[model samples]
Target: MANSANALPETGFLRLPQIVGNPHANPPIPAIVPVCRSAWWLGVREGRYPKPVKLGPRTTAWRIEDIRALIASL
Candidate 1:
């Protein structure tokens, strides 16, 4: 899954878990944008982060461009 994130070709959406990232203890530690689900929702409500798009009744995601912009701003 981490590889898939790094492998994204150009543009797409990313689910919350993917955005937060996975942790590994081995060599070449992956970059993790760690944020708890509640804190993320709070950021959304406070406009500190991009609003997510509802892909279905129980699915939500944010645009890759928006996530990149947020990372750049930080």
Candidate 2:
């Protein structure tokens, strides 16, 4: 699926890799915010980005609406 902000579903969650960009792609695509992983984490820590929800011991994601809001703010 297309990972652009406009292509995200209205209600769901997005993992860090998806939020950053799918690294598995043949040629890496830019993330919505196009920042490095460390920067993204820093944003989360500093409250500049949405906090993630822990879905499982090895799973965490952010709400889609929260991502949309962040995009809009930018």
Candidate 3:
């Protein structure tokens, strides 16, 4: 909850806020990767981050496994 996505389950997908966080929300979700949204997307576009899964026309998410692997690599 502090600096990493270890709080996540062993298998699943995570939305953008659940990954980069939403500090202004009711409960103030902590960041898993600790990067701004734009930077995150840039990383994605540049192939420095994991590809996302489109769950809906407007919903994009990344696999928990991919995030875990990204954290490990970092």
RMSD of each: 5.0, 3.0, 1.7
Worst 10 residues of 3 by lDDT: 1-10
- Mind giving the per-residue lDDT tens digits that candidate 2 earns over 1-74? 23477798889998887788866787875577778789999999999999999999999999999999998888
Candidate 2 displacement at residue 22 in angstroms: 3.4
TM-score head-to-head 1 vs 2, winner:
2
Q: Look at candidate 1 and tell me the lDDT of residue 46.
A: 100
| Residue-wise C-alpha lDDT for candidate 1, range 1-74, written one tens digit per residue | 44444555458888886676546534433443567768888999999999999999999999887777777667
What TM-scores do the predictions have? 0.72, 0.84, 0.91
lDDT: worst 10-residue window of model 2? 1-10
The collision pairs in model 3 are none
Give candidate 3 misplaced runs (Cα > 4 Å).
1-3
Model 3 error, position 32 (Å): 0.7
Cα error, residue 41 of model 3, in Å, equals 0.3
TM-score, candidate 3, is: 0.91
- Ordered by TM-score, highest first, the candidates read 3, 2, 1
lDDT of 1 at 69: 72
Maximum-lDDT candidate: 3
Which residue pairs clash within candidate 1? none
